[model samples]
Target: MSALLPLPRLPLTALAVAALLGAAAGVWPGAGIASAQGTAPTTQPSRLPTAPAQSRGTAEQASVDGVVEAVRQTVLAAQVPGAVVALQVKAGDRVKAGQLLLRLDARAAEQTAAAGAAQVRAARAAQDAATREFERQKQLFDKAYISQAALDRAEAQYKTAQAEAAAQLASAGAARTQSDFYLVRAPYDGVIAEVGVVLGDMAMPGKPLVTVYDPTALRVSAAVPQTLAAKLPADAKVQAELAGAAARITPVRTQLLPTVDPATHSQTLRLDLPPGTTAVPGQFARAWLPVAGSGDARVLVPAQAVVRRAELTAVYVAGADGKPLLRQVRLGRTEGAQVEVLSGLTAGEQVVLDPQAAARIR
Candidate 1:
């Protein structure tokens, strides 16, 4: 009766586990906890045999679900605060590097730059007058027409004017640089995935305005438990199945992140999709990474063999006497027509194919 009890406090029906199973959705239904009180005595199922890893396929211990992402995705942000004045591109538009994407109001920056230029011109004129006056004073002092004190005053004024001119020139250059910020350009050649602004929208520094991504290069990213991370091989043949796609994606490269996520106790797994693998960012995908060695190799049984019930997943095993006993098992990734058994069953053991028939035998 304890086995019949719900896994936790809540007693939900078997239907709750199916949708959440994701890629494991192809199995048959049988999710109830059978117990001694049920008074069922069962015999071996109609078909009895051990399904080996070689027969099902040399695959992963479990499947890790992930999302397809572009290898180079960037979000363009505003560096200068202004209202959007012109929008040159929208979502789905292809743009070249340095191509104009949008424009912001630059009337204020333009005025500032103009004023700085004017100051530079005025300071240069002052510097020219000061230089001529200093030269004339030096000539007068050399000929004894002016005192040394008078010549020194003229030299000081000339130096001051030269410093003012240099300062104004630098200020003008900075103003000119800031004035160019009103135009926003793409950093690379890619397709625009999103546009977060419209004409007349007020833009602020660091505000995201566009999202672009390269379609030629992409990958699917998934997170796997750290316990299993050590067993993934760098050259392992990782395969990915995209939602609604018939073909499985073969990755050109597999990358395992060195750092573990403290909160999830998992590490990120990256599978670089092969070139021209028709996939877009944000699409859902399931990846199967081959674990190193066969020491902990798992078994796969037909989905019909496992009974899902009351938020619990269990299966019926045939004993040596051909009598069946209900055993609880933890479920792993579900591939087409089969599910991986993580625990509660050993290799070479006979698993009843039909849970309904096994329930009758029990």
Candidate 2:
């Protein structure tokens, strides 16, 4: 019985394959462990301190955020369609009035003008010959050497030549005027804000090629709600706090736009920065407008409670479930540490007192 016993065996290739697979499995877990040790976990947002919102009736003054802008900003467009051949100026370059900013391909325009000039010269030559012929005919008729009919025919020919010469002269003028369109020029003294077209680019009529702005005359334009806009008198004196450390709170001339925006229900207020003020275009500005009436309840929160990201502004609102949720909000103006909340929150609701504490949520 002992001599008939036998052992089961696997093929040599199968055993080698199994050994390689087990080695690979072991290497994979070690690689995963190394990776897990090198990577760090994401940080969680910290819990922010909360406070109940309070209502503030109409105050003595209202402030609104505004952007400092150039009094005259223009996006220059091409008057003629052609391939751009040269660019004379770039972004942020200072330009003078009538200065050339760009040039387009002028071969076609030059050819047209040359042709017109040639026609004008030929027409003038024909007119001069006609005049000479008429004068000779008149002299012959005066001497009784030619008939009246011949002189009259010569006069008719002279008038026709004069008309033709006039037409050709007008054509030449028009062609020259059109040729001027191949050159783009600045309208006023300003700095080039942007260059939209490059050399060899096809520029079409009405296509924007560059933007220019007069940096000397800057203004701050803000959108004020219609409710507050109507209350402020037309002659109310406003003051703006220009941005930066060396900035001064100076009195600015305010012009209320007559129309109200239908969608936002706000009116645009243009505040002219006083002459000699050291402020640049596109800077942040805030204007303090005198408030008229009282008894209108509005919510005011600390400026630290609001979060700003580029064009988006938001705040942390505490829900009934004791969770703080970030919500988008529209902000009006700032009064020192306090800011006006235009929308997205109601009075008596709890909000995060410090937005920085929850910055990780963003």
Give the candidate number with the greatest TM-score.
2
Query: What clash pairs does model 2 have?
Result: none
**RMSD from true fold, candidate 1:** 20.5
- Candidate 2 lDDT over 1-362, as tens digits, reads 56875777956786577667768877533566688899986655556688777788766677788888899999988888999999999998999999999999989999999999999999999999999999999999999999999999999999999999999999999999999999999989989999998899999999999999887788888889888887887677777777773444655566889898999999898888777677778888887788766335678887878888898898888766555788998886576887878888888888898776655454
Candidate 1 lDDT over residue span 1-362, tens digit each: 35675556766555666545633866434433334446665543555443332134344445688999999999999889999999999999999999999999999999999999999999999999999999999999999999989999999999999999999999999999998898889988899999999999999999999999998899999998887777877567778889888778778888888899999999988989988888889999998767755346657877878898898898888877776678999877677888878788776678777677667654
For model 1, the superposed segments whose C-alpha errors exceed 4 Å read: 1-54, 57-62, 141-144, 234-253, 274-277, 292-362
Global lDDT of each candidate: 0.83, 0.84
TM-score for all models, in order of appearance = 0.62, 0.65
Off by over 4 Å in 2: 1-58, 245-252, 293-362
C-alpha-based local distance difference test score of model 2: 0.84
Model 2 residue 345 CA deviation (Å) reads 18
